[model samples]
Target: MPEIVGESLAKRLIAWGVDTVFGLPGDGINGLMEGFRRHADQLNFVLVHHEEAAAFMAVGYAKATGKLGVCAATSGPGAIHLLNGLYDAKLDHVPVLAITGMQETSLLGSRYQQEVHLDRLYEDVAEYNLMITNPQQMPGVVDLAIRNALIKRTVSHLTFPNDIQIAAVDEDPYAHPAPGTKPVSLPNLDRPQLAPGEPELRAAAEVLNAAAKPVILVGAGALHARDEVIAVAEKLGAPVVKTLPGKAVVPDDHPVTTGGLGLLGTKPSEEAMEECDTLLMVGTSFPYGKYLPDPGTARVVQIDADPTLIGLRLPVEAPITADAKKGLQGLLPLLRGGDSGFLDKYHKEMESWRADMKALQDESRDPIAPQYVVGVLDELAADDAIMTCDSGTIATWSARHWTIRDRRQYFLSGNLATMAPGLPYAIGMQHAFPGRQVIAYVGDGGFAMLMADFLTAVRHDLPVKVIINNNNSYGQILWEQIVLGYPEYAVRHRQPEADFSTWARGCGAYGVKVTKPGEVRGAISDALAHPGPALVDIDVNPNEPPMPGKVKYEQAKHFTEAFLKGQPHKAATLATVVRDKINELRS
Candidate 1:
């Protein structure tokens, strides 16, 4: 039995279900990479081009799979580059175990080639940052990193010094993880409560029972509370309209689910939110209050685990601080209704909206319709396919188009909207669910930011499919310019288009380039069917704009004011625009 340091640490990470660690290797972290390579049989090391993408992929993997994700980098610049992605994970509550190799311990105070105080550098992004001083502490620190990451639901870090790379402890203490390292309990926590204050529960139950038109507003916290949401909705005969973060808590196409509400929302979801009289904000703090109409005299009953979040945004009529699952359990038994018309009406509206949206997709034959590509993708994916989406218009399309029918999982930046998250995210998701199908939807500009990571995915043999919507420009900026009435400038990629397909092929990844609308789906399907990593670069239609909830009457006004100084005012309300849309759906 050999004593160990980074090598043993890598070995132990594998036992904890960390199959792949995404990051670039450099001088400072060469020892860690070397250690990882030595244990290649036990752990798979992903050599990415950028530490940033490495971090993001870990974030994605953790999100899609519910396992603590691992990513590594060298000290100095490598460590610095991880900040953006790490923060994204930190803010979104993903569990990531970040490891970095630093300069020799002897160079602690010196400006040696990549010597920096990494512990301090990563302080803000990690829930727990461990600086390994000796091999003896390796096992504890590694285990601590994993446990803390899962418990706190945040990024955790371990920094290794070059001098301690091969130090021999009394023994290879971290040979294996203890049994029950990962629990199989309910993902949503259940605990003892203050009996939910009988009066409060009764009042909440009565509010739900008596209401005819009820809307369930779901969010990410709601995902953990899925059973609770469904139970309440079923008992009360209500429709569910989730926020983007809460999209898959209930099947998107569930008869009771109107769909997700946000900028890229469907007519049913928006109308349901606007028209419902009693709103149940369950386990979600939907940050966008503007989307919440002054509630049209609607009453709100919000259930949240975090007490601070209750009534933190908009005041609620009934705010319960108990766990959503428990609270809903108590409330559901008290209400019984068979008003099937609510779901029936939403189903009808959903069908009409789908038809109109499909018609819009069919109209986009100019170059490649990303919308239609997404729809075809929705068809190709298995019922349980996991999708990681990049921020931008791609998020818009995925939200509106990718039906969570039957089964599926979707990960988006939600509110962060980081530019280059999808490719790395696909890697993470694939890493987590090795046998499950994982795909990343990205835009040309976003993919360009971290396209080099395809090599890392290849090296790990992660069978993740990356679909790039190559429209030759930042589509979001173009939309911004359009809404603002400004001339398009500098938003397009100025660099010569790197042959991404060739780049992938060169890295041992299958690559498909689809320029025409007709070829997009076939290329994507083939790449997905491949046994290993692949990239599909499809030239998408640029004129297919990203519309955000009909554009805020104020933001649109500001865009016009800033860009078109003397333009006529766009009408505040357009009755003709959504008139028949509402009728066709809800009439």
Candidate 2:
């Protein structure tokens, strides 16, 4: 048999260490699917129900492993279905390679069936997008796409014309060697170390060392630099505040951590931002500028790999452009230890904040509070479990109360903030780390959107545990409307209330429902013990509010008025929330 381009592509992917791929099969990519089949022992293709899930699984896999993730789709609709997940990877700065099939070359400009301008469609989401029309370019193009994705920390796209996929490979595209050297045999695809110059590092250190009270804000990009970030925080006696996506960069229970620093953050973080004279931002471009201190009030020192993002969100007093690890390493030597009083003050506030949260978690209501459920689940979950969360109120709760520690990985649709990624991310995480525990905290709104994929887990025998916050409503939108001084409308998911656990059982997985606080731990424990996929539907209190870190009087007033005008029946719940806010302020 002659060597085919598709087979060469498969072999190249395996050579580059691609063990698994996620996608659906279609006529446009049948030739490529055959190649995958030929290399079954070397490559595993996970068949997902939808192309969107395939892309999300790719994003999830990249996030969990910090390596390149690959996904494939057919022409037109299949390629279009990948946009949302591709955006998630793009915005979050993960490495992902997307392989899309195009109509045959002969059919180009002839309006072929399912024909799509895939190269143009993928332009915005991919840092490196290319179309391969020649069969000889197969293995080389594949290698280049993977290298670009890994090196750029961004998405790369390849559009292969259907007919060319199976065409005969005549010569090696990579035969050309360097000047006066032999033909290159093996490719070296690796990222180079990026660091700041000595002067820039010294300038950043001077700004930090001169400040009387400094605060550290870390983001997802700083995950690999956790130890360095912690050391800098300790040296400066600064309290660490995480952007939502960076929640796990430092253990929440760490002494220097004041928790997250936005709407979903803790009071200590909010207070620290208000009082700090200097801010050291590491590897984050958190979009909410209003949540951060006024640029005039706090001098900013930013450290990031991307120069364009160094001072994008706020004005920077000192900018150090380097990878997080190297950037912090450069600053550590010039840093001077400050008075311990600042961190000590915030530590006391953090303790008080935790106590207040505990009171809410222990509050006995007819319907169990979601906080209580998450609190107990936090205690019962495996120390090293990977937790993927959906957007909206579920993200808020998990960010604020998840108690991430012990090298547990946390993932969500960070910059895109898209819905329905929790389950797909969980699926991918479980696929990457088969022996590690994987859990997804999903809201009913998100869960309903992609619940069909639960069967994927069952079919693959992936033992992922899903915890659904069954509030029967778009909880986040409801609160958003109220806080914006508008009555809640069209946010409820009423009637035909779903029993997610029962639905899971029907899909050949373990199922359980927890309506009482007492059962939260048991339900979670049972799900973990089950040797297969499981769903625990937690019917939490619908009236519980995801309060902001720093609540304004105007917001409280608006929330009260909205509740009275539209949901008069829940006036009692509104009053309770108001009273709690007042008490929090008093403390």
Candidate 3:
């Protein structure tokens, strides 16, 4: 058979080191599926339950391995389904390439079935978008899509019409050129090394050296520069405040580490930010400006590879547009050691904060505190475990209770703050690193959104442990309404309480439901020990709110107003809040 465009595309992806493709097959891409079959030995196609899950899996894969993640779909709706996940990748700045199918060339503008203009649809989400109309455009388009996705750290897209997918290529796209003609070389996939200039480094160091109390804020951008960030923090005696995505950048047990910032943060972190005279932001434009120091209160130095993100969230006195690792390396040598007093203060505060948190993880709680469940997992999980979290109150528990140490890595929908990616992300991480343990820390509401994909894990025999905080309510939304002085409405699950464990068992996976606090640890331990996919549904107290680090008077007033305004479970919520505060005092 002649070399078709689909075959050439598959071959090119193999050449670029893409071993797996996460997507569902459809008639629109029947030719492409055939090509994938021909190269099945070299490339693995992960058949996902939904196109959205496929896109999220690609995002998860890219986030885990720092490589180009690829996902494909059919035309129209399949292509439309990829938008949310693609947007997640775009906002998080992860590299993902999306391939879709188009209607046949003859059907162009004929209003045929599944005839969607994918190029215009993807224009906003993709860094590079193209629709291949000719067989000759195959090699260059594929190369450019992968190249742009990697270099720009965003989504790239390509759509091929059904007729064009199987069309024969007339010439060798990768062959050596004739005399006086240029050769077609594959695009380099490696990212270019970028470091701050000497002047920029010196300027940043000067600001650091001049400050009496400096706080280093790290984000996802600093994930690969852990050592460099540590060196800088130690040299400057700065308290390390992590953004949620940067939770693993520094171990929670580190002397200067103060846990995460913003709503899902520790008191020490908030205090450090409130008091710091100089702020050094690494690879994060943490969006909550209220959580940061006042605009002119502190001098700021930010290091990021994306120039567009520098000084975005705060005013910066020194902006270094370079890779986090390289920028920190250059800035470290010029830094002068500051007094250890500031770090010492926060270290003591962190100890108190941790003690208070430990008090809340009481095993005596009847409904089983979510904190207790996560704390147990933290104690039992492997040193190199990978954690994928869903958005909502579960994120609160994971951020506060899970201590990331050693080789443990955490992934979440940081910029998008979307739900349902937890399970899909876990599946992707398990695929990327088969030997390492992967767990999805998701809430009941979030897990319900994508629970069908649990079957994917079972089918593949990927042992992904899922720990669900089964509160039977939209816990985060409930808390948000209360905090805003509004009575919670339609937040609680109206239907019969979902027993996720039974569903897991039906899907041919290990399953357990833990209602009592005493059962939490054992259930989690067993799930982790299972050889295949397992799910643990632990019923937790829905009334327990994820309180902010420092609850302001306004928030307190709102809580009172919400209760007075006839919020459901008002008595239970007030009791829970009061008990938690008393526990904090006792600690």
Candidate 4:
């Protein structure tokens, strides 16, 4: 029997070094499932509870390993379910390939069962989108889709009609090739070695060397250039501030580092940005313009692989278009040793900032503080662990409290800032590094969105530890409402809160619930030691506010107005805020 399109596509994926595919099975893609079955030894299909989870798993895998991530879904609604995760990949600039199934070719334009136009639906999200109606499209289409995803660092999609999926190829497309013609082959995965020209490097160095106070801002693009970043920071006497996704680029305890910058940033970081005369942005296009130095007040030098992002966020005096690693390497030698006066100032501020943060993690609080929970996890988690975080107040705690040390890697929905990727990301990270420790730090609302995937962990024997900040509310939105001068309306969770620990046990995994501050550490320890998948549901104080780095006058006034206008739990919120302020003063 000749090779079928589905089999050919499967073989092509394996040839391109895809060891696993995440998806849900359905009748719409029966032929593709058969192909996956035949290649079971080489390619493992991770069955997800939802197509959205499968797409998120692919994104998590791609972000963790820097390899092309692949996911599949059936036609119509299954394909529609992939939009959220695909948009996450697109916004974060990760490589992902989405494979979808379509109705039979005979049903073309008939609006048959599950006959949704996937090509049109995926247009905005995909860098390359195609529908395979012919068996001969085979290896060529698959190869192109993978290449587009990897090369562009974005999403690629392909939809296969049911009838065409099983059609046999009559002839070898590679056989009897014309002279000087090369047959379709696996794409080259190595990134092109790109560096800024000597003139550009020298110009950027001049801006840095001339400034009396220089600050270095790093992002996810700078992950691979840790040493180079440190060298430049040291030479310029600059404090290194990271974007959320760039948290792991420099260890939290590094001498030149000053944590993250933004709403979820540190006081020292915000100060450095405010006082700096020159801002050096590397590998990141940090979207929040408010957190950056005022335009024209500070000279900007930016280095990134994408030329379009060079001056996209802030005004640039010198823009170097090159990979973060190469750009930093070239500029390092050109930089001259400068005064340590600027860095010394922030070092002292960082010391006080650290003390204030430590004070906020008081384990004596009756209702467990979310800060305390994260601090304990930071202390107990393995040095080389992989952490995946969900959006909400959990992001603020993770950003400020969880210190990235040693070989630890952190991944989150940075640009998209979407919820529900936490558990799926951990699952993907566990699959990528089978023996390494993987943890998902999520909020009650975010976890509850896709809690069904906890079974995916047990079924696959993936040892992923999940820590839930069980506040029983949409805590972030609640605070946002107060800041916007509106009373909290629909942010609270209904009565009879979910018992996630019980849910974990039902899924055949280790489960622990901690209600008091004292039980926090032991529960976390037990969950981490459980050997298999585990979940820790810690009932934290819902009224505790995730304070910003520096509170603005307008925010304070609006918060007060909201409280007067009938914010729920206003007394509890005020007490917690007062207690934290007192601790800060004492520290």
lDDT (0-100) at residue 115 of candidate 2?
77
Assess candidate 2 and give its lDDT: 0.86
Q: Candidate 1 on 336-428: residue-level lDDT in tens?
A: 774878767887888776776665454236556677788888889899898888888888888888878555888877667789988888887
Q: Estimate TM-scores for all models.
A: 0.84, 0.95, 0.97, 0.97
lDDT of each: 0.75, 0.86, 0.91, 0.90
Q: Provide the clash count, candidate 3.
A: 0
lDDT of 4 at 283: 92
Clashing pairs in 4: none
Which pairs clash in the backbone of model 2?
A: none
Regarding lDDT, does 1 or 2 come out ahead?
Answer: 2
Error of 3 at 112 (Å): 1.4
Question: Clash number for every model?
Answer: 2, 0, 0, 0
Q: Write the number of the candidate with greater TM-score, choosing between 2 and 4.
A: 4
User: Which portions of model 1 show Cα errors greater than 4 Å?
Assistant: 11-17, 30-39, 134-138, 170-203, 210-212, 224-228, 293-298, 320-327, 338-345, 494-499, 555-587
Write one digit per residue (lDDT tens) for candidate 3, span 100-180. Answer: 999998998999998999999999999999998777776767877888898889999999999988888655434644222
Model 4 stretches astray by more than 4 angstroms: 171-190
Candidate 4 residues 185-231, lDDT tens each? 53345354577898899899899999999999999989989999999
Ten contiguous residues with the weakest lDDT in model 3: 178-187
Better of 2 and 4 by lDDT: 4
Model 2 clash count equals 0
